[model samples]
Target: MTDIDAPEADVKRAGDEGLDARLVVDRGPFRLDVSLTAAPGDVVALLGPNGAGKTTALRALAGLVPLTDGHLRLDGASLERTAPESRPVGVVFQDYLLFPHLSALDNVAFGPRCQGASRAEARERAAAWLDRMGLADHAHAKPRRLSGGQAQRVALARALATRPRLLLLDEPLAALDARTRLEVRAQLRRHLAEFEAVAVLVTHDPLDAMVLADRLVVVEHGRVVQEGAPSDIARHPRTDYIAQLVGLNLYRGQADGHTVRLDAGPSITTTEDLSGPVFVAFPPAAVTLFRDRPTGASARNLWRCEVEGLETHGDQIRAVLTGELPLAADLTTVAAAELDLHPGAAVWATVKATQTHAYPA
Candidate 1:
């Protein structure tokens, strides 16, 4: 399990710097090839669908999984052949993975003990970490006696107790209940902010990625499809998967000046000036629905669509439409009822050119 392609010749790499890695892992039919970098004090999130190799990439950095190719440099040294336990790395897994038989403090102290600290010294360090995580009172409690949030905090405390230069968290909040997740997520955010180290978190939850990381790297089928500041990625998703995750209607097309002709046989005018292959996107709420096509509508981008389905989403009704262009539209229940929207009902969908954003593909 500790096998590596080749060990770096020198051990001069500093632990306090940052992380720069290009990980490539091949597992029969699957292959993960992604490059990631994070500065000290920066938290980067790896987000994608299931089986997207997010956890594999994290493991490769931790040395639990071997890299088929590529290199991993932390701060300024190479960890291409470092063992998992020897690497200056810590991991908080999705399940928290606290020893059921051990007390919270003992669990947190275990890492320091493994690193050669005296029993008393390890306990002292563990106490400080638990106190920092607001779990000083639960230090004596076993993992079974702790609540979900408490156990999560203990796991984080254990990981941070190791004083790793590069910390890895895989679905850090996935084990908690909805209510506990909210509380733990906030607490975890604070802890991550205080850590002056390179932190990489893997999560499928968009909210978690948005709230926890300074930047997001989106993986798809073992490849990095997008990487950017959270806000930029949210506003301008380059792929359909990203657009769907961000709740937008996206269409690929060819752009000429302010007009783009969709590959689906519809043309949309956008305010952006772009050419060649492009993507035109807009919010579901930007779409206006009408029972019938209106003459001389101010919105020039129009499509005659048939309502494929309808469902209540929060305070709005989300309608799936299929026709000249396939897309989802969000309308208030009142408006939907007024238009008698239902499956098979014909409707006109319109969006203002100003509301649509077009970018090069």
Candidate 2:
């Protein structure tokens, strides 16, 4: 969808939640300058690698870090100079930071109580939130007694209990084990979907970003490299990091009729037509390797490559190759063994032009 179709109501709520920030922070040699906006009912993921300033951006929004420049507006009101507690924003940290001394119910009630709710009212609201998060049965359990997933849900309930217009979560599921991550991820998705305010989450996991956010903001070296729907970004990644994250080999080329010439020196024949600058992408599994270069092959794209690295991913072996074009090829262990492939082995990589997809770059 176009930017015009983006949720204006959500944008207003994001401001109301008190998270309008044009964060410009400098730490000696490093500088983070970014302009961000969020709306109620909008879940935006701040995604990037370590030291890419994802957390710095979040901290700036939450008032933990001071903005060196730029204005912050919440609900059209200024927040650049507002104190953290005075803002309506709620934050869930990477570690959840649940009070170890408090029961599940009490942990959730802390926010509303601090907000000046009476004991009875806070307890009632906390109970209701616990029930919503499926933690009502564990209301009396302390953080130490609860599972990772349960603690995460409690932390989320606590954040929501404050009735803030903007919600912030940092690595919400990073503390869970693989098994628990799957369970909590689905549960988190439901909660995010039901949240009516603007929500921003910071995560390095692509699955978390794709599953939780309506839009993804990819940050690298303190700049947004890409932003779009999960599927759209997955299909058309603009950077090597994004391409690797989305598990596709992306190439830019020019297409004439059925033939596409890659800038990397491989010509592919496809069924698409009418293209100027185009992008071709395929998964590593789509590439086939040959012990010897096959002659008169019907496949349109062929290249000679030297294996740069090899690693096993589950039952499959992933071969990293460098040559006329950098490519990754997936092969079975049996095939790898048959070819005696090593880091310096020579191989022929081929792809049918039909398997190459061309889209406007």
Candidate 3:
């Protein structure tokens, strides 16, 4: 469907010299409102859990979904009333949506044909793209005969062949096997870097977002929770979802000097001293577990906790603790065996103040 019907006089403009959009879509009980802006050559990743409205935002930009409010613009021209096929947008969907009936060259040629290129011109352009993608020899292969990586590259070529002003990638790497994913991810990163247009990517994998995107926009429950450079967000997460994604234990609290009293009635000691509401965060490895209280522990923050569960985390074991405070501790197999960790096992958890980071909430 096209965007919400509006008069030409009422149409809004954005994306001056690149892309800028404030997408809002309302569907029954769900509403998606997201603001996006990017310059040419920028690669932005949209990250979220299921039903977080990430796909809806992407569709709105593509004109696949109608916008209830807000505007869409590319190169400073209005697209709020543009049809999906008419918009200067290209999409590489999660499934790579290639036509099984078409050969690889024909598939990539389809876009230019639709845009009014002659048969010979389209084929020549498609051949150049296929060659650039390292698929020149596979031009005659059908979609079914192509490997997952090959299909993905063909899909990307088809999208890029259109010479769209804005490109959208939905879970570009989710369809590949681990090995193929590794290879394609590197190739995709190189292609994206060379793309001079604005590109928006959607994925649930933290590594993909970190590796493929220049900036990250995190969505949750139809709203943006946080957004910034991948490294900045990884080191200083503002929400629990971001904290978990970056492998850290985070808590909200009110800070008084070095002590931050958690909203849940516990206190965390941090290295930074500041007043008012703040966030305290640290890595799971910062926690140490002991079967009995040691006479002289170096850690000043101690809590009586019970092991709620245990799980393998890479080369270490992650223990979930509850009772005096909720915490996660990472310990080696030998340490876990010495503590005899299990559900309901009581232990004392200690965290050195130096390991905790404090920042304004």
lDDT per residue as tens, model 1, 29-97: 999999998888889999999999999999999998999999999988899988889998989999999
Off by over 4 Å in 1: 1-16
- Residue 281 CA error for candidate 3 (Å)? 0.9
Can you write out model 2's per-residue Cα lDDT over 116-217, one digit (the tens) per residue? 999988998888889888888999999999999999999998988887777889999999999999999999888888777678899999999999999999
Displacement of the residue 151 alpha carbon in candidate 2, Å = 0.6
The stretch of ten residues in a row with the least summed lDDT in candidate 3 is 1-10
Off by over 4 Å in 3: 1-16
Q: What are the models' TM-scores? A: 0.94, 0.90, 0.94
Q: State which candidate, 2 or 3, has the greater TM-score.
A: 3
Judged by whole-model lDDT over C-alpha atoms, candidate 3 comes out at: 0.90
lDDT tens digits, residue span 1-361, model 3: 1111111111223534889899999999999999999988789999998899999999899999999999988898899999999998989999999999999999999998999999998898888889888999999999999999999999999998888879999999999999999999999998898777789999989999999999999999999999999998998898888898989999999999999999995898888989999988899999999999866988878999999999999999999999888889999999999888999999999999999999998
